[model samples]
Target chain A: MDISNLLKICIKALLNNKMRCFLTMLGIIIGVASVIAMLAIGNGSKQSIRAEIGSMGSNMIMISPGNGRFGGVRQSGSSMQTLKLSDYESIVRQASYIDKITPTVQSSGQAVKGAKNTPTSIYGVNEQYLDIRGYEIASGSCFTESDILHANKVCIVGQTVVNELFSDGTDPLGQTIRFGKIPMKIIGVLASKGYNSMGQDQDDLLIAPYTTVQKRVLAINYIQGITASALSEEYTDQAIDEITKILQTNHNIRIGQDNDFNVRSQQEMMETMSSVMDMLTVLLAAVAGISLIVGGIGIMNIMYVSVTERTREIGLRMSIGAKGRQILLQFLIESIIISVAGGLIGVVLGVAAAKIIALFGTPTAVSTFSIVLSFLVCVFTGVFFGWYPARKAAGLNPIDALRYE
Target chain B: MNEIIRLEQIKREFIVGEEVVRALRGVSFTITQGEFVTIMGTSGSGKSTLLNILGCLDVATSGEYYLDGVSVRQMSKNDRATLRNRKIGFIFQNYNLLPKTTSIENVELPLMYNRHVSHSERRERAIAALKEVGLGDRLTHRSNQLSGGQMQRVAIARALVNDPVIILADEATGNLDTRTSYEVLALFQRLHRDGRTILFVTHNPELASFSSRTITLRDGRITSDIRNDRIASAAEVLAAMPKEEEE
Candidate 1:
């Protein structure tokens, strides 16, 4: 009737069938390990994404043009050229929340160097754009406002472009490079930035002044996208709001009419990415939960077999004056001990599993919360699965049980 | 003499798929203090069922069974278990010792249910019981490590550890050889002589001769109840009985 008696009986029973008890605990072990490992992988991926998004300037915002208008026909946003230089100038002058603004005009062309020519994108922007988008000059000085005013063809090249053209890691500052018959002077080399989430070649770009791009390279008065930085991180929302209102009024669009452009902050992008990662983690956790359920079922099945195998023992205890509750408690304690012990072992295995996967170049981080949750899940499985078998053993008729062969 | 146990019209019926099987048919009996009583019956004569009821391991279908002035039939299931723990000890044919437990631990089991007993006292009593059964040297042996006769003696020690008012034995010597059974019976006789009330169930007539009183059951009813005023000691009975040749 006392807990110590039940504990002693449980210990003896489990020790008697050490192999079976270990095998039974194997299911729980796999269950907890899988749950922990899967959650770690999922959470690690989420953290990776957040870090990636954070590397992009938190105060930065991107504005892309909307679809072009036609007679009863709509065009894709990529085919539109609704953004203009005046809109960029207006944002800089009229929007108090905007700290710096720049327009981007992009085109792909072959850059000729000695005998090597490589096809790559040429992006046009001002000196402020480099600071706004979190860039630093590795070598020579960036083109200043005087360069933009003079409509200079001076350019800054990405590290990959420099590597491709120079090949010897030579200082290519103030050198001449030709893009589609337009020869330009390389004033600076942009610092190396790794690939983004979309796997874009961030350092394989060539930068030129917006005026030169519009007048000579692309030959269009409209810009493709506008990049801007907020005066402060706290002012990003205000900056985005003021830009939207200005663009909407400049385009002369009525209420409820589709705007000609879209404005988005890095925070919004990070939030959207986090939600996607959250869904992914939950999905992985759910899949792992199925394995835990299977483990619970295994425990139930094993406990039933154990009760049947120990029928005579149960009867003997009853005859020796163990109450129904005592029998129930003994069996239940046996299962709980197995499950809890398995849970502890599984925690170690799961952490090691996560670390191993991480060593193998997979993103995985074991969270303390997941460990506690997995351990609790194991205890729950013990009680849930051990209940029916314990009850069956407790309810056995002493005469029949003692007589069981 | 105080009546240690009484059975008033104890009737137990079994239900088997809408058919009723009468295991015990209105059997009534009384066992006085310090009396060694044996119930003799073949299989299915309800002697085992009677023993189960007397041990408080089974409830009768209709009965007014009393032990030491307490009505067992009306006691709650937990109370019945407590009564079994405090008032009765059971010995079985197969020894029913927990296979994983040492002899000393097995003897301490019943006392574990009685919280009022101190741990040292329980251990002391268990050791004393082992000593009484001539098993003081084998206290640490598991059931499988002991011989058939030694295992039975250990079971007896476990039964007597609590010093219950009655020792209920259901075919205590059924699994033993002739020599071992005689040894166990002699141990029982010595226990009885020490003023312990004992109720032993066995179908073996030769084994029934060792008890002070015998009740025979036939077809779920008591066929004969007789008191042997001059019952011989188990040693005398064993010495006179014909021994079987060794295989």
Candidate 2:
């Protein structure tokens, strides 16, 4: 028989019971839609994370004090304070790949500004800390090198500190805020930087000259950490290697001894974060794929029922000289049509769902690869699950089938 | 006349749950073209088995059967199907027309399996067959819309559409009333007069006089095969009977 005639017969048979056919296709629809929507949501979040990390300066590197050993007990890195100003000066003078470097010291305290007190973290660093960490000054000016030399009581405050310390319509620049009875004038207000991927508020901190916090507030000479930016992203690894060697030499650590500090780059962090996101996307897609298999089982079940219901019709066709393979092809074609049509509809629904999700403030991206993959999977489901039932229908004996009530 | 069908010692056995039921036991017959033959038997006489075997819908356990000089027992399953498509037309008892299908589409079903017939030619031949059966005006009517006699005419048109060597009908008029049965039998008689070989299987012995030959089966074996010198014409029988109201 020609394919057209076979298709016509199949369409007619399916059209005989419209409700049943639609119910059979519902499983496939849900399967494909979930697959597409899950992948889109996963991909959207991944892109946004990469963007957030990119904004934190791709070539930036950080160095912190390593844990110290005292009396056979390990002390935490924060309490060690092994990082020093001499080590930072040695890396700045010797490292060729490093373009910017700054010593860092941190202290947390309640800042009281005219009876409006707010608890916030205070970071201490040189003027280059803003450029290295991709922070911008929205208003006023950054403290000059003269201010660091004099251990100036000047600081830069982020948007969150501004909102907490200053009332509405009141200017924050040039205002003095007391940090544990040590008042520091705000020289600049940093621009807004929203929450990071880890849900940490980036704009809820303060920046001041490192020497001021080291000499006046903490009274210790050892620095807490150091931040630096390489000349370019490509030179970040080389810069870390050179700086590590310089620190090892300056700290008098011999060749066999472990260094007293840790060096980390933004590139390494990006690689780790992206790998975790990729694994998550695969996991979500896998869970959604289970629905596709379930949908295939639904198709197989309906096809079996359809064959049993149409036994007399099969006998009639066989009596009219329809070969066994022809009958198999007719039913197989019917299943394939149902699945493919369901897949097409599912693509539309999935994209719409993704768009609606994105509109509600969650990111979503629909990729063509997922669409094509889901469609191919749907076709495979139809063929794989449809084979057994079609074979059973083809193997029916014409005489017995005709006699079947 | 060419001998279209010949059966030699045809035997069909069914293994019904370890019990070998011999449905047809060594039956033999020969039928030629243009013959109106009837095979009659009660319920358990193996007449239905004989008709199934003759129509190529079943194979005898051990027999040598031929159609138009081709050995049927040696033919493969697919070859048998092809031969059935090209050489034998079947009319079932219940007017087995496909439900919800138009009359012309139902008649065109047999030709759909024949690769040599083009699409337009199949339609033309189906229309001609319906016209021959006096159903030309009812081509578009579905099977349920037609009367019992009209449905049988549509079935007859489908059986003739393939231009088969012979027509095998299994109790073709069994479902009709007396008047409707006579009308279908008259149509069969007209076809037989046109030189079409026809075989009608029925258990009603009263219908035997309508055919030119009668063969009776008893207990899986043929008890009698005889030619009737004076066959009753269905038209004459209808003329002599009183007219009935149209149902």
Candidate 3:
């Protein structure tokens, strides 16, 4: 028989038992919908994570003073002071992959202004620190080359620092706030950066020229670390390589000896985060896949029952010159129609569910691959689950089937 | 009359769990075209077995059975199904119309299995057959909505749609009341007058009086075959019977 004729017959039979057909399709519907939605949520979160990491100075590199230990003595990068201003200057002059550079020295202390005090860390950096570290100034201007040359006590404060040190909501620009007895004039107020992905408050810091912190606050000659931004994200690795070569040669550390400073880039962190997200997406999709499999089983189950229930119908068709293969094809076509129809509805519902989830502020991305996969899977499930029962119907003796009550 | 069926010692056996139950021991008969023949027998007299064999639903274990000059005894199941599709129509006792399906669709069923029939042609044939069975106005009525006699007419229309050489009906009137049964029998008589070959299987001896010929079976074998010199008209009998009580 031709497909369309067979299709009409099967459709008529399914419609004769509409409730049974719909219940059978429900399994595949839920299965496919969940699979699509799960994959979308997973992929969505993965992309958002990448965007979040990219927001945090995606091409920025940091040269710390040390790598935790040297000669069995615990030497932290924050306190080692192996990084120097000369090394930073050498990289700025020689490195071609990086477009911006900054020398940084941090000192933590309680800032006081008219008896209202709050503890905050002060980072000493050059004019390019704001651009390199993804910081934007809300008011006033950045510290200039002239300010660093004279070691000016001018600084930029974050929103949290402003909230803590200033009692009233008055303009703190050009006003001096003391960081442990050293009164520094506020040149600019850094824009608010609510929080990072790690749940760390980003708007809780102070910035000044490295020269001032080095000479006046810490009384130190060597700088703590160096931070810089590559010309673009793609040049991050090359920029790190250039910085390492410049630092290694400047420190006069031989090839066999470990360099006293460590060079790191945001690209490394991005790769690690991406791998974790990929794993999570796969996990969610797999969990949703289980539902699809269960749906297939449900289809198989109903097909068997339908075969049993329609034994007399099978006999009638057989008596009317329907061969075993025709009967099998008819039943098989019925199941496939059920699953394919359910699959179509599922794709629509899944996209809708994902969109609904997106409305709640959760990221969701529906890929064509997921929809296609769901379709193919539901079809396969129909065939896989539908075969045995159809065969059972085909193998029946026409006489016995007709004689069946 | 052209020969439509030729049986040569047809035998069928069944192994009922270590017991050999011979359903049709040695049945031999020949039927020509345009004959309204009834095979009458009691339950367990192998009448059902003979009907199944005639419809090509079951193959005989031994002996030869030719249907419309085609060798059917040794034919494979699929080949027999094809022969049944092309040369035979079946009307069951239950009517067996697919529930919730329109009468026209039910009549269109047998034609669906034949690849030679196109969609529009199938519909045309189904409508024509239904109208032939006096169900022209009930073409779109679902199977459940039709009465017992109407359902049997739909079944008869379905059987005739494929233009089969012979129609095989097994206890077709068993499910109906006297009035409905006579109405269906009258319809069959009209088809017989139109030269349609028909085989009616039933246990009712009274049904044999309406047909032009009668065959009696007992103990899985044919006991008697007789050609009626005087055929009782089902239309006259139905007209003379008391009218049905309308609800």
Q: Model 1 chain A, poorest ten-residue lDDT window? A: A1-10
Q: Runs in model 1 with CA error above 4 Å?
A: A70-74, A110-120, A138-140, A165-169, A174-183, A231-241, B13-26, B60-63, B118-121, B219-223, B236-247
What are the candidates' individual DockQ scores? 0.66, 0.57, 0.80
| Two-way DockQ contest, 1 vs 2, winner | 1
The TM-score values for the models, in the order shown, are: 0.91, 0.88, 0.89
Residue-by-residue lDDT tens digits, candidate 1, A43-63? 888787777777778788999
**Model 3, range A95-143, lDDT digits (tens) per residue?**
9998899989989998878778888889999999898878999999999
Residue-level lDDT tens digits of model 3 in B97-121: 8878899989988889999999899
Candidate 2 per-residue C-alpha lDDT over A1-405 given as tens digits, one digit per residue, 9 for 90 to 100: 888888888887888778888988888998899999999998998888888888899999999998778787988888887888989988888999998899999998888899798998888899999998899999999999999999999999989889988967589988899888799999999999988878888999989899999887788899999899999999999999998888887788998887778899988898898898889999989988998889889999999999998898888788879889988998898889888878888889989989999999889999999999999999998888888899999999988888778
Q: How much of the true A–B contact set does each candidate keep? A: 0.69, 0.43, 0.90
Docking level for model 3: medium
* Full ranking by lDDT: 2, 3, 1
